[model samples]
Target: MNSSLQLAVPATRNRAPVGPPFRRQARSRLLRADLLTVIAWASVSFAVALWLADGGAAGFSTPAGSFTALGIVAGLIGMDLVLLMLLLVARTPLIDGAVGHDRALEFHRKLGKPSLYLLLAHGALVAIGYGIAEGLDPVGELVALWLLVPDMWLAIVSIGLFIAVVVTSVVTVRRRLPYEFWYVVHLLTYAAVLTAIPHQFSVGGLFAEGTWQRWYWLAICIATGAALAHYRVLEPLVATARHQLRVSRVVPEAPGVVSIELTGRHLDELAGSGGRFFIWRFLAPGMWWHPHPFSLSTEPVLFDSSGRGRLRITVRNLGHGSAQLTRLKPGTSVAIEGPYGLFSTAARSRDRVVMIGAGIGITPIRALLEGTPFEPGNATVLLRGHSEAELYLGDEVLELCRRRGATLFHLTGPRSAGEHSWLPEPAVHSGHRLASYAPDIADADVYICGPDAWARSVISAARAAGAREEQLHYERFDW
Candidate 1:
């Protein structure tokens, strides 16, 4: 096995900026992450406080009043949690910068079942409380609510919608459903929230005419809507206009792999390191609506202070949208959202670095090789593929590693079905592990990009090799 490629080849020139790449503070990110946690919990606490401020304590003394008061608090907390979920996924810069877009999305998903449960509890408690007050059964009171109360029917429908959303979001169910179908179902959350809001103001005793609770709820809903519109809608439009990215050329890298080069104005102002990502929407027939999230294969190269430069993304025809991308023509306009993810040096916590990439996943590692700073022997690169051609831009990577003084290893062979190691068949037989290439991997920040299962294998090996959680970084790009 030719695993050890020549280290010191003829130095090839690169387009990276002269000097160290941009630096990010791990401390700042941790502090901001902490702040977000405090705020999320504090919002729930504030909801309870709002209830306490308005005779909530005295109402709980009587059994019927107690059920009514608890119902009100449950509704408030459920509403708060729902709103927080929306804000988490609004693609807000604050959340993305603090916890990264993926982590924010993870938090968003975790709240689904809890928020649904709270809403269900709110409805049941309110029905029982009202039934006791009116000397009717809970079912009779619920029937009266649906028939007589304004917007109560809509609230009932909202509960059904919330149940549908949560059921589809469960891991097993989500796995069986197509993503588009899941997305459409999840969008019903807004409809559910809107339908439920009317009863909060119209029927709830706490939010009676011109009460502080009414305005507070109104403000939060408005703010959440505004944030969603700005970040997810307006910001993409503004960026499309400001940068004006257009396809310059499309170059085929290997079978099923192509690189799309895009040129735009002020590309240097793009606020991300080489390994970060952007969600791209190419404006063309049948393709303009589909968004593709891809990391830069090459960082932007600005020629002058005018910020006129080019950016490139290497794509493999993994799906329908990417297959369409491989056929893109020159001069096609593009709209974008982000430069998000923690796959860059912004995630670095140590001086040394180890980068691992398998198959087409090596593209982002190539960009990182060009832009990240490291001393001659402080960085290591491992490329895993079934063959050399599967390396997809292996030559360029080798050049970059040589120019940047980083070690490079090529593990190319068939898979080993026995042990399921991330290394190739030959390497697995030889007992090579993640630490074999980069012995200091435990002290280095390890960046991995690849298929989900393969990346998970790499992660497991890295962990077994003593790599800390914070020291290992990877991005899961799901649009």
Candidate 2:
């Protein structure tokens, strides 16, 4: 209802040069990613090196000794991997800024299975090695250890918890379970890590007190825990209290989509770039515990002289957690964590820009188009949907394109029947591709958001049309 609430762009007609600054930022991010990769591998190497320094290699001279040595190595690497996974999901700004939150989480998911395998191997091999030395079978040795060792039972419980967490996380099983159910089970990961710690310090001779290995392991574990607490727990509380956000209004955008607006203090400071998202927790009964990551549908609007402003996020009823958002009433307090991801103007590498969105994914594109800097006629907007009704906020996107002198296309129709293409059925049949919509796409920065499969198709098309990986910015909608 209020057109003025849309983002305001500078009235300048001159185009800002995009070469040097864009390259510098892109190079910086690449370096950070490279550094993180190095650090992760370095940690694993250091763990092995610590054992070698303590004469671990000499243990490999015999069959039983070799098994024990291998088990020690497996445990060390597995624990290191567990620490890395924690840091990845700790919401640390360094990781988030370097690779984006979604990519970081993807890496975390990948490490889960490998880490679990190593841990399981560690337990089995250790039991076999001990059994051979004591003239008993592995199962008998395991039972004896459980009965005789001080912390073996806790270690066994830790492994069981790890198995449950990893099993529920598999894609097939995860789809069948409720998000909350999976989330609660995932929280048991902390308990698993804690339970496994006692044996490492108290039973393992490698990390005995006063040794450098002990100090090194202790430092890494403590740092990981501290980071999790500060970023995942303490930081959200601080941000919520600092912003003092409250629901101002809720406006329906489409059949199942709604825009929830909020007013808060020092909004400009918290105002993330267009296309960036924040994890919002509405302090309402039965819903306060679920955090929803939604992007701004419009830029934050600074309303008065005292730094108070309003921001809005458009969401659809895609899941149980998000379905409850439609019932949100005015004045409900909000807790937030982020402004994360790289699908914004900050990732631009060229003056020319192309934005493509499908269904509710069009919301963030609208926000990005509002405030991102580009010359008149240098930007292109493409909205794809099965029908016109699915193009939520179509009118506003068209208005913004017209005012900014950018080309706009609304591609509405059923998807291609037999092939995996992002274009509509007619366009695909006619051999019209991304290049047909934006002829200079190779020289443009392409931003895409949509369902996972559809977005992947779009990305493939862009790459085939000669767009560089650094020039393609994609935000996943189904996180």
Model 1: CA > 4 A from native: 6-24, 209-212, 417-420
Cα lDDT tens digits, model 1, 1-479, are: 43656474335534333333322576677788999999999989987887787767887887888887788788889989999999998988888887888888899999988899999999999898898999988899999999999989999999999999999988889889976788799889989988888887778577765666667778889999999999989998998999999999999989899999999999988735688888899999999877788889987888789989898999999877789999999999999988887888778777889999988789989998887877777789999898888998899999888787788998888876544467787777787777778889988889998887788899988898899887888877543
List per-candidate RMSD values in Å. 2.9, 3.6
Q: Model 2, poorest ten-residue lDDT window?
A: 1-10
Clashes of 1: 0
TM-score versus the correct structure, for each prediction: 0.92, 0.95
Native-referenced Cα lDDT, model 2: 0.87
Clashing pairs in 2: none
